[model samples]
Target: MNGPAQLADLLGMASVQRAGVALLVGSVGLPVIGVVIVGLDIIPVRFAMMHVALLGAAIGMLTGLDPALCGLVACAVAGAGISPLARTPESLSGAMGLLMSLAIAAALLVLSIAGVNASAAFSLLWGSILAVRVQDVLVLAALAVVVPALFWWRRRDLALLLHDRELALVSGVPVRRLTLVLLVLVAVAVAGGIRLTGALLVDALTLLPALAARRLGHSLTAIICWAIGIGITVNLIGFLVALALDLPPGPVLVLAAGAAALAAHLIPERRNTSWHASVH
Candidate 1:
């Protein structure tokens, strides 16, 4: 069959395929939020979430439960734990490192106890979008709405916090509250996103678009908008391409996003020479 014909067949092949594609579209929203937060220097938080997700999956496997649901709970708890540490300059990176080490070690231990092979454990980290359950889709769809809504409603506050937390505090914004809230939201969104790109490649979906968008956009709002557009486009096109090529979706999607980010450099950066001259 031709490309379009093949894609149509994939979509219509089975209920599971249609469900997976639907989930893919919904889950892309998580990466949309990820790009915005990652651009604000919260990349470590996302990484930590991935570790927690792995641990969650291990626990689920050991207990014969749903790994994805367990992962969602683990993500939330880790977010709460990491929030305070994120505020302390001396502890931020250290705490994340500690959590990452512990989480990975615990995951391995649990997998061993459960008699699950290393490859199976590792598969959780890579994920299989085609294997997502209906419940996973529902969770992702809710996060898709909630995460972007929170960011959109508090765009200015988040921008201020990202620009300078101290300044935001001095300006009477609730820095700690907002920071914690954002972290929690990030955790949830990332947990949902792991279903699509897996823990390892989530950044490819999130950061690459933000990085590329920042190169082309003059403002934070513009960057976020462009990132969302880029993210959706990359996921959709990547999914179709993967279907056509009979390849894995996660890596293909990431590579596509990376290519777009690379292409972004071709757009010449705007220099504020006049403003600098005036200031000088």
Candidate 2:
């Protein structure tokens, strides 16, 4: 009887371990997918556009129209800069330099004229998604669905563009039209995710999974699926941790991503010792 009771207890402990492992695996999937969608141009908007003065645009959209459309405006601004500034490599580092300057100047001007609170403007630009409401989740869920679905409907065109823009255009992939669509999709994700993660770190949300997927993902499709799973899991777990620690969700989420990246790197190679044939 004693031995049977001990065995049952051990089995229960094993079950717990299995559950814990599943949760961790799921958490690892969140940022991976979010980043992949961004890389795939499923979400063109980055937290990049949540500038001081841009709050007015978002505010207007929030009040009347859809927040995603407002984000599209910002994405357009980013798109305009990308080819001329960000893609230049030489100019990329400083691309935000002038824009930041202009944005600051404009923000100051608005402050003088409209008397918007400095903190409010800053908050809108940065955002706080730590303790989000259901409404926020709904909006994010919708964008998550719409943006990815659109990309799926036209994955070939996007793949071509990413692989080689000139080739895509030559192949009659409607490069300009699709590029515009992709940028808009990004804006939607950026705007939606900003409520939780803030503006500056949007790239991290979109990039982390891509980094992981690149390592574990054998093919593009597999990479994206795995990436989304990572993004969603990290986000949920990070939010919970942020709640527990009384920390900022944005930074907490980023820290989670960094940890996962480190773990991925630290993970041991599975090659057997017997197979250690050093050709070098």
Worst 10 residues of 2 by lDDT: 271-280
Question: What TM-score would candidate 2 get against the native?
Answer: 0.65
lDDT of each model, Cα atoms only? 0.72, 0.52
Question: Candidate 1, residues 87-134: lDDT per residue as tens digits?
Answer: 653365677778888888888888889998767656766766787767
- Distance from true position, residue 215, model 1, in Å? 1.9
TM-score per candidate: 0.86, 0.65
lDDT of 2 by residue, 1-280 (tens): 2255553553366433343333333333334335434454433224244552264444443356544345445545564554344332335335445555665666556555655456644655565553344455555555656655654676666656555556667889886666555544444445555655567765446666566654565444555666677666665676556545556657877887666666665766443221012111
Please identify model 2 stretches exceeding 4 Å from their true place: 1-47, 52-101, 131-135, 265-280
| Collision pairs in model 1 | none
